[model samples]
Target: MIKEITCISCPNGCEMSVEVVENKIIRVENNKCERGISFANEEIFNPQRMLCSTVKTSDPKNLRLPVRTDKVIPKNKIFEAMKCINNIVINKNIQMGEKIIENLLGLGVSIIASQSLKINSNNV
Candidate 1:
């Protein structure tokens, strides 16, 4: 089987084609660098993606705060991670880079606040 993929490891976005037989890569083409080969293999065998989304915050001024995983998570677990993200409400004054969810789903990745949220004066 032959598969085509676009490398996202860099801005170049090298388009690559791979020839596979019985779940093994036989050849690769259209790669500009060694990273392209690695990207294709990982994409085909174990795809991963970084998660980024907004979560509810306690502050009225900023009812929602942006969050993201510190590292890439498995593609399959993205929806599950989203579920965890959606269920949480940040009741604390969260600083940028604060951990929202540590070791999310035991995948060794933490969901962190992408932006800071300060407590509303009215709430104090």
Candidate 2:
């Protein structure tokens, strides 16, 4: 079997091809670094996503903001993970790179604000 992927680990986005036998990767090509190799193996085995979406906040004027996790969660738990993210309200002044939820939903990934949300007086 053969699989193709664009490596997201680097800006090059090297177009890589993997040769698999019996569901196992036997060879890889077009990868200039280890990152590409790792990415390909993960994709060929357990594909995951670094979800990027907005969550509704408690503030009325600024009700929604972008958020993401420090690590990618299991693809099988995408819906469940989104549910957990959706239920959260970041009222607290989230700092840049602050860890909002540690190991969210036990996926071993922490949910965090992609951009800091400040506590402004506008929120009444």
Candidate 3:
């Protein structure tokens, strides 16, 4: 079977055709660089993606805080990760890059604050 994919490892965004047989990559074609090969392999066998979303916050001024995984998590786990992220409520002001959840889903990736959020003084 031929699988078509666009490589995201670099700015080239090379569109490639990957031939797979029995779920194994047999060949990769039309890639601009070696990274495309790697991308194809990882995407075909064990795809991953960085998770970014918003979490609920106690401050009405900042009702939602942007958050993201420190590193890529399995693509298959995004919905599960979102479930865990959805259950979290940030009650205190958090700095950008601060850890929101440690070892999320035991995947060794922490969900971190993507932006600094402060409580509104009027709400205090």
What are the clash counts of all predictions, listed in order?
0, 0, 0
Better of 1 and 3 by TM-score: 3
State model 2's lDDT: 0.81
Predictions in order: lDDT: 0.92, 0.81, 0.95
lDDT of 2 at 97: 66
The global Cα lDDT (0 to 1) of model 3 is 0.95
* Candidate number achieving the greatest lDDT relative to the actual structure: 3
> By lDDT, is 1 or 3 better?
3
Model 2 per-residue lDDT tens digits across residues 1-124? 8888898887898999999999888889999998888899888789898877777777777787788888887788889888887887877677666777788887788877888877675774
How well does candidate 2 match the true structure in TM-score terms? 0.78
- lDDT (C-alpha) at residue 7 in model 1: 93
- Those runs of model 2 whose alpha carbons end farther than 4 Å from true positions after fitting are 119-123
lDDT of 1 by residue, 1-124 (tens): 9999999999999989999999998898999999988898899999999999999977777888999999999999999999999999988888999999999999999999998888787964
Off by over 4 Å in 3: none
RMSD of 3: 0.9
Is candidate 1 or 2 superior in lDDT? Answer: 1
Model 2 Cα shift for residue 94 (angstroms): 2.7
Candidate 2 lowest-lDDT run of ten? 115-124
